[model samples]
Target chain A: MSQHPDSPARSNSGSHCGRVWVIAMHAFTQLVRMKVFYFLAVFAVIAIGSNFFDLPQHTGPEVSGIAVLSSIKSWSLGTMTLFSVVLGIVATALLLPKDVEDRTLYTILAKPVPRVDYLAGKLLGVLLLVFVSLALMDVLMSAVLQIRSSMILNQQMDFAQGRGWSAAEIASLRGDILSQGANASLQGAVFAVFLRASIMASLALLISTFSSSTLFTSIISFLIYFIGHFQADARAIFLESGAAGTGPVTRAISLVVSLVLPDFQLFNVIDAVIEGQAMPLLILAKLTAIGLFYAVFYVIASWFIFAEKEF
Target chain B: MLLAGAVRLPLEASLTGELRAAGLLPAPLAIGTRDHIGQTSSAVALGGLRTLVATFLNLRAYTFFTECRWDDVAGTFDTIVELAPHTIYYWETGAWHQAFNASSYYLNDSNLPSLRRDAAWRASVLNGRAFLERGIRNNPGDPKLNAYLGFLLTDHYKSRAFRDADATFLAASEAYRIAADGRDALPFLRRFQLYALARVPSREAEALALARELYQNRANHTVTMQCVYFSLESHANRSLIDPGSFAVSVFGSAQQAYATLTHYWLRGSEHLPVHGVASALRVLEAQLGIPADKSVFLQHPAQDAEDE
Candidate 1:
């Protein structure tokens, strides 16, 4: 895919895309060598272990025997969410300090690479790692869910048959069981997890740009993460000012918190999906838009801060 | 950073509004629940593992179940369902643990006084019903919740849990009717409707109509359905139809009719009406080989067992 020798891509690597891609690949390789993908093994164990939760079986025909399928998706996706967010935050937080510690920051700055390219490239690399980890975990989850769903489907069909259910009833049972299985909605949910992690990664990048140390960045980023879940509530309080008899200082504080923190709760459609609710593509699109907005704004802010740094 | 926040705040607000309107996001976790979950759990749950936290709570509830801590079981499930209100399994399991397991434990508890045991048993059943009703409200279109409600209302073995038998059956019939709505409803739900409605004295006409409609389907020809159909038909308009013809039509032969009617007659716990069963059984048994010693009247002892 390399350009011809005379082309711009081959000349001095001055093209921003070329430089950024190089850095991103370098950073991706750097993170990958850290053995971060080992978490997928743990994820597989969780996915498989969740399948064994059908204890004290429900004793009626009203519900199918496939509650375990839902349990599998819930546990797997939950693990995926935890793993992805941690990876996104820690990896992004580690990048800048580790680069500086290795003196690669100096060498890279000694080149023609812009600081923005370096930061953006590092963020992209973390994103790529997160995306790849989530994709692997999603594949494992979908596979387990698909297999378990088929087994549950068979069990339900047999149970329905023994109960002499009609074709319509059997079809309904099949649909219910399949809804809890791996489907497009589940894929959309996994993507929502990824989107949440992506936003966290970028936010960590922004924090790391001004942060004194990796530990500080990670801690502050995590604090923001937990607080971000309440950002909407703060926004609501600010929006409905004086309804609760609060004063102006409280309102100002809430407004600042709401305006600053990314609302992490919006990505919680994953919970609904785990509950077997259908996720409309339009809703996923809206969530994607929100994610992109946060990610882009954070990266640009990081660029603005890093652009003038004496390092 | 503040400039970026200023530029994107409205956009974030607008998208958040849209997402909330679309029901793609849940409301913020309440402060009380945050306190209940504590700092570590609050952090993990807010970190996008809310359902995982709910799952752990479910396991904890199960442990409470093993230890026979009924209140703790109930409390953990309350937390679990709050974390995952859309999950039917949590609701169903919670209700089952309360209504069946915990209630049964109370019923047989030798340590408790009789009155206290009875009160605890009743409370457990009621709590389970309330939980299921809450589950149904959260998941309005779920046939499983409706069907489960119907089962609980009309359960023969647990009839003591309900206050008014007639009203309970009527409510059960309604529950089944809702469960049977749409093309995908299980055929048994409609049959269950007929069964429950047939037991309601004031709803005999409506029950007979449903019974007739469901009788047209071959899959609804279970013994209970046939018994309900015969009883409802007799209760609705006994003067219009001959008992023997109806019995033969339903059970295929005189002997089979007698035997099936005898079984239905003896199931005292089921609360089935014997409006036409006895007279029809008499005529059929007289024609069949039932001797004087083994007459249909001899089955009164078993029928009386249902009253006890």
Candidate 2:
């Protein structure tokens, strides 16, 4: 097979990083051309529309705009989660089969490219797509939230001034509104969304390595995604079940299930952020470590299986 | 995969516990909540769209609110809070629906017998209080929820729903105290706490100290706060100060003291303590040469007269 002039495999200074970048960018362009970014438009609408959910509040002026702020974060982050996960799984599940069907995998393997680099590149591509999409969504969410929160603060200040609210009261109200606005915690939540999607993408890559078809990979990935949310609960039952008189058989099964499934519940700190809780950097760092751990393990596992497979 | 899972399982478990302790992760969904949210919502909620499901249910609860389906409103909010227990909006809205909207609905429904209507109204108020108390439990030290509980306890009409006045005022004071302790709590919350505490006869000494502390800040010298402070002070030092002289010193003049004390005295439905108010009003009135028939004491308390 003839190598393209721009191919990393043909470069004079051949490096794994260069080859992975080339393949990852190729995958990104391929997926982008599939018009996956179009979902960002839908996300824009959802984020902007969430602002209008300013339901007639029953509380005093102190909490006037809070529900709307929560609404915006909930709708925005929720849409990001859904879109990123779907894009991560579907885009990844499609990549391997599409490459095979196009005979591109054969051509790539025919080159000096390592299979692990190729797998890493492809997973990185899906992750890049998910990260970019979430970043864009986060920007839109932050913009809408900032503007709405400012408007709310102005209205609340006017009301407070009219009612002769003290300086401390006014400051307190402003602090409350701003806490729910565009803040570092909200950014951390968007990053958490990206991390969760990255895990899904890499996991889907692993599933697709041995999966018979795209449909099989997608279905299995989704099932595992849902079941992964419950893995922590199963683990808990196993850990604490000794005194609860759970039979040995039950404990053993729970242990096996817990040991085999990814614990997706660890990423659910996003919910608390939506409720205006602060996300400590330490926690986000821990979550990042977990995400990297999962992705790296799944990708290596995929390579182990793919390394021996006959294409 | 097993080895990887085994290695990460402890880390994951520890992280899970930490996240939960930090209020970053909610408790696992209860089985009944799963049934309540139904198949699709439960699936969505479990799929990491818990807050999204909660937002949708909030809309649904609004519909139930419009149709006067109080039970449906309550049930839907039950599921909403279960999904997003950390969101104070859902908790406050749920409590409002029960205490204010549902109670008022039953209050004015003339078709039912008065006894049944009264029972339903009182039950709705109690349910609202229970819901707010549950919210406080879930979000301990949350200023908004605590303030809300305090407001519900001190509401003119709703306070009647509580069977024990002293315990009700004590609880309200405690709630306001917690609320005032919050970092962003309004300064008024502290004064409100003092107001609630002063109404609790057993807590008058503590309330007096708080009132003095609050009064040192002139911003807290609202008419209600001043009146509450004066009454609490008199209760704390009943034998130490002359009612008329102390009243004048607090209010700056006998006429001003009489005017402030009269207003406070007439708001009997608020359940505020009177202490030296009536005696001070009498001395002020006598000194001002007010006629017997025109005396403030002869005028019935406004809310008491309305009740009669």
* CA-lDDT, candidates in order: 0.82, 0.88
TM-score of each: 0.91, 0.95
Q: Model 2: which residue pairs collide?
A: none
Question: In every candidate, what fraction of the native interface contacts is reproduced?
Answer: 0.51, 0.73
Q: Cα deviation of B140 in candidate 2 (Å)?
A: 1.4
Compose the digit string of candidate 2's lDDT tens values, residues B1-308: 88988898899889999988989999999999999988998888988989989988988888888899999999999999999999988898999999999999999999999999999999999999999999999999998899999999999888879999899989999999999998867788888898888888688778888888888987777889888887777776777868889888888888888888888888988988787777677788788888988887677532322121
The local lDDT score (0 to 100) that residue B118 gets in candidate 2 is: 97
Per-model TM-score of chain A alone? 0.93, 0.94
Q: After superposition, which runs of candidate 1 have C-alpha atoms over 4 Å from their true positions?
A: A1-14, A48-65, A151-173, B1-23, B301-308
